[model samples]
Target: MSRRILLVTTLLLAGCTSGTPTPTPTPPPVKSGFKLVAFDSCEQLTKDLKAAAKKSVGPWGFSGGMMRTFGAVPDGARSAASAGGTADKAAPAFSGTNVHEVGVDEPDIVKTDGKRIVTITGGSLRVIDAASHKATGQLPLDAWGDADLLLSGDRALVLTHQGGGDVLYDRKMPMRPAGAELILVDLTGAPRVISRYRGEGRLVDARQTGDTARVVLTSQPRITFPDRPAARDDDEDRIKANQRVIDRTSVDAWLPSWTVTTGDTTEQGKVACNDVRRPVTYSGRSMLTVLTFPLSAPKLDSGRPVSIVADGDTVYGTPTSLYVASDQRWRLDFFPGRDNRTVPQETDVFRFDVTGSEPPVYRAAGKVPGFLINQYALSEWDGHLRVATTDSAQQSSAVRVLKPDGETLTQVGEVDGLGKNERIYSVRFIGPRAYVVTFRQTDPLYSLDLSNPAAPRVTGELKITGFSAHLQPVGPDRLVGVGQEATEEGRRQGTQVSLFDVSDPAAPRRLAQHHVKNGYSEAEYDPHAILWWPDTKLFAVPVNEGLLALTVTDNGLTEAGQIAPRASAMQVRRNLVIGGELWTLYENGLQISRLSTLEPVTYLRL
Candidate 1:
């Protein structure tokens, strides 16, 4: 069937099948004098009684009879399976060396052939020997101010900023321009620069397929003008002239380009940036990129880039094509409505074959209604393309699974009763189910059953006590979630590292919890990145303050070490633990140290 027709049919089928009401099984008769009351009715009665008692006699006296009669029911008892049940275990302890003094921001580490490759912000890359836990070599580049890094094979592509107009709302303040560029770093031997592409935003993702690499760039232009109250008729011209100068100055303060290197070199043809202001996502073989407008201004005329993911030969570009083939074929997936409101809507997957073709053919696949494709990831489940999406609009932010053709977008299951405002931030497909980190209103780790992709359900959810920013799957039955707890005074206080047991996707429990110090008011306190080192059973926290590493065990987390950064900025991907050493990226440069010794081998000053 044609893609569009198939999508319509699939949506129809989903509506019909999903709406087919399951016959409510009749409850067995209650024993003796017991009577059943619906949860909603009980809740209402509780509210009313509380209000009445507040205005009547003593609080306990007024509701005593009601509580005695209904509150003791066995069904109302908090079960071990419930969110705050006592059966929930404490987080496990993390054990390992405590390495400190490594300065870096938003660091990502990967191991290859007994060597560790560490990429950090500020445009410096370091290589560490896994066995020795020491830095073997380092490479620095000029384009390293808040750059992103990706590793594919041996080639590293660095995206830097060039120049673009900036905006300011206050006339007294100056306007600044946006600048970005992309630089390719060859990491096979002595690190050297290869190709550089200039732009306004950042180079998000790069995909390597043989000799060609596709690089994606975003440009954001913001111009803010002064708004002065009506002045006296005599002063109108003077005010207008002052406003003009402010407008002109706002457009000139452009920062230098920021760039980093990745291991991708395959050249995939380039495509123009999408004009949409909202986040755009593209699904690749194993990576996904979520592009959002510039942080300073609206994406009306200037495009913005938000998030990017790079892994191996597959790269996904956001806000353009829902799916991009390595050959550059673009598949556009509509939000299933005409208004095109940026808030997520039901997604209709479409197919575009970009291989050896120009102006790729577009085909509709299927639709996933009630489930909005807010954010997604691509994973391999039994060799099939396992696409996972976070549907924030649904009561139970759903995770849908689809076939590689983008056909058959099925609601395999959902995480119900996650509270009204709770949302799933990231979804990771591990084994038979998918592990998701729910944030905001409900802080918990949920395991979803994707075995039956069309009807996936939340089999288990374990409250982790704090808000989570990211989750990393450590094993088939284990996951590490990084989050933060705020103090009673409303300050970002401590880092909460939670480990979950997903042996039963329907009954996950916290295995451990570790709270770290160094909560900074100026820093973005959100635990942005989490990495699990199986070699040492250690978990690392990449925060704005610096890198925090902890050792995990059956008991709980133990402070392994912490590296304080020279200065605090949002650590987009600041610190990483590679080959048993900590690699940190700072505004000054890159810092490399051994995880066990906490000794610095080299500080490649940027």
Candidate 2:
């Protein structure tokens, strides 16, 4: 295979709400399984908060109080015909941002509508016209670090964190305080910030359906601890002091605060108590707030905010439902005994109904035995939600099907003991069939039959030498897997792309395999780094520092070519197929290439 190195100095790229009075609390759904219950009043919420905090408080704060955040998935293209591209027109067929579901767009570093390409790089939002093939306009943002954005018609919502990316800490250094900043920009002409929002925590993720965007933020309680304790103070003494501080903290201090600025006016408020809900069992340590914003509105206002007293690590959204799952890391008891036993390894999932343009309504809650790997671990289909989990204690993985009854998600069917002694690496649900990959020493790909929700059983299993970290469906009967090629001893070598034929659920087989020694691709773990053009049957992934493009065939994967921009210092973060041109986004600029020939064209430096 031939390789193209497009050298260019200039081309490279880079990449809510306020409180309001809520309506009367809806009665909890009537289900025999677990559920989330809203607090009746501020007084009741305060009482519940204090009691939970006081019991859970310890020397460092709430016991087992660390929060986990997952990486966002990559861009997705709907179809070759969409985005206003036709062979008869001056522009060729084009592709939009790669997303998980149709009509549900995720925030990404780059986006396009066939005519123009918009991206964020070096704290600035840049736009390039496809016709002119040149930089058109730019807007400098007040961003702290790296950023991503969601596009809706002539509007763009750019998300940034205060600390300029994830912070690292050590015994000698202090943890940097972080917050999330969302800037709403108008894309009618030159991009300009029309409104700005600052929230108390980092952004979990955001998803858009049509003109509405829903953002998820996770925040810890805003309580200060003593910098230095007395010399005589011990662990127990410090624990007591932290508990006392929790006792004096008011309900407002535990909720997430927000400030939204529009022109000369600004609104500031914390999440309302009435809008907060909690599971029957909670540690009350973290607040998970979901804010809904109308992106096409004249000006961005404080969004409709609804919050829950739980931690959100993974967020998944479909057209009609949004699911948030947490690993539930809190301790079982507020006070620790000598044993210091913690809560069981489990994940709590909350479902919200997002049918209309209104704010999402809390619909149901459920618990699974093990924790989820990422957003792909949860799939909703045919009025049933399927969850894949791996329990460390049991040394096995399982797929459980749950149905929402009134206010709870009750398990209807379960298949456990899968890949015993291994952990789940990837999972994908395609209609009635499900594929699960688990790996320790070797990879076991399990095909499940979910045609009957109440009796989901594993139909077939394929043991391979490596594991796939991310699985992408090619069509109705094929899947493309991106992961590591490992040894018999479970040692990973490099990046491997495998073609899986699932035409027969009872017996699936690997059609072809391509291995890159010492190669690593972000697409292995972050699906957002992958670009699949179905019309051409081309799969492009960021391997090492360049974009590796592959041609998928029935017999095998043909290496189309590797395209790396001239800016070798910066990594290729994303790639887009816009009107016969392959637009590659680097950390600093953009590179345009001829999609058919994989040849370099003009490049733009932002």
Candidate 3:
């Protein structure tokens, strides 16, 4: 809701070993520690992906439809696999505020300073003053792809992925390059452009502690072999063509371009070669970048940029540390082509120290069992990091606590015999306690105690017909869960909000359960999409049909009212409470309603 405090922990860099440059061989080895590895040239990456693709994929029995899913994979390999930037609203006046997370601060599509509401889901940044209840001047967006806004004091940072976008900050620029732009806007009076930093990558996510913000970006190179044949009759021909073309390329061809536009001057160069670290597997090309900036700084480039040679899919951050996790299974070759049948069954955890530094420094890397469900699957506490994963082959979910040991993560505590024949539905970490929800025929909420890092164990388990996809703490021992209500056979019925009391870890009980028929909410997936105004004790979630509102208290949850959905799109993307009013954001405009009466205040069509 406002400024967040960063807490420093002694165990953050406890077992972290000094980073040393190690000369690595081809097909980089997977070690317990992280090392810097370069591709030598673009040719190496081109050749490797083709060979991996040919081996994983078999004959030409597939179409070109599946190739669009992989973010940075080589072209022509069909089938299998895919996959926010952070997203928040305002806080209520009563009990604390409605921030994105309990301790973590993530960027969102909309944020309010009690007096004004700022939203960015389209080509421009719209600033609405809560006091006036009117639309103010907007910052014109000029780039393509997705963009998000972050605010602190008199400054606002606009992150844009320059690929394909409809609205933009600069209209005269015809071609939106395949890069990114970090435009700094001064919010002292009317929004005015201050500084712009042009970069190469997609904005993964960002978090702010007070005025300091850490932004993560993933950059992939676009490589091509001019001499390579477009069509090959056999697999061998394809492989040789790839290798031949790759041999002629260099490393610079695969590196991302970087530039900073300050006033009338611009500086350009490639990301430093030695500042990157690579994973063991010859997975495709992608660089994980962490850039840090101060919100009150005069320019956007008044920060530092660091990168790792890894493909990060999920990220979790604390005030002093940031952890990035990647599932290297997608790079494995198990067929005649890069087929999507069998994915890797392991995850790689990399930790970076962000305490008292402009940018985070890579500290260590370790391997963990199975894959994570999302960012919530990782947590750092009590001088150790705990990860939640599910082994698809075994159909079991488990929690593992790892301690930093020099360059590796040594397992100090673990509990694996919990949920079987099912996957993890939700995971929430509250201090030394962990609540893991797994569902198959039913949802089992297992409580785990991690007070002793050497021996974390499950304290209790409660089963219900439906399941929770997201978990939130209503109080110290109470949790508010949002997910789908299901049948005994595991068929999803609709959205269900359940309250649980875990005062006694060994005997947790369901306090209240309310089911919304045929209703699905975005809070089930993106937790930032939830809006709980403490003043009225009303919780609002975006559903497929409309905005479902409910009154949540210690007693139970009761139906309040529903905000009318958009006429054409018929969907509510985000909802937030500011200045004692409810704001529902859609693709076209914003609907403001009185928090008490739930009556329409005004509509600002964009």
Identify the leading candidate in terms of lDDT: 2
What total of clashing residue pairs does each candidate reach?
76, 19, 27
Per-residue CA lDDT of model 3 for 1-606, tens digit only, reads 111111211111111111111211112222334444555545455466444333432222111111110111001100110001111234233211233234445655665655566777567888887777788868776655566667666677877655632112223454343566788778766788888877765555666665677777666544442222336446556545544544454566445667777778877777665555565653435567788888787776734677766666566777688787777543533344544455567888888887643677777777777777766778788788888888766667678878787767767667774566677878888789999988776888999888876667777888788899888776568788889999988789999999899999988899898888888876776666676655576777788858888888786888788887767645687776655677788777888888887788888886
* Candidate ordering by lDDT (highest first): 2, 3, 1
From the highest TM-score down, the ranking of the candidates is: 2, 3, 1
* TM-score against native, each model: 0.52, 0.89, 0.81
Candidate 2: segments with Cα more than 4 A from true spot: 1-32, 62-76, 79-92, 164-176, 229-231, 330-340, 565-569
- Give lDDT tens digits, candidate 1, residues 201-310: 42333322222233444332222334444443233453354434433432122211222223353322222222111112322111222222111121111112222211
Error of 2 at 473 (Å): 0.8
Query: How displaced is residue 497 in candidate 3, in Å?
Result: 1.3
**Model 3 alpha-carbon drift over 4 Å, by segment:** 1-103, 162-178, 225-231, 279-284, 332-342, 566-570
lDDT of 2 by residue, 1-606 (tens): 001111111111111111111212222322424777889999999899888877666665653433333544433464322221122255455676655666677777777777777888877899898878898899999677658887766778888755521222233556666688899999878888899999987677887876788999877777766543447677788778777777788888788888989999998988888889888877777788998988878876667888998888788888899998887555533344522755577889899999656999989898888878778888899999999998877677788888998888988787777776677888988888889998877888889888888778788878889899888887668889999999987789999999999988888899999898899987866677788888788888888888889999875799988886465437788888876788888888788888898898977777
Worst 10 residues of 2 by lDDT: 1-10
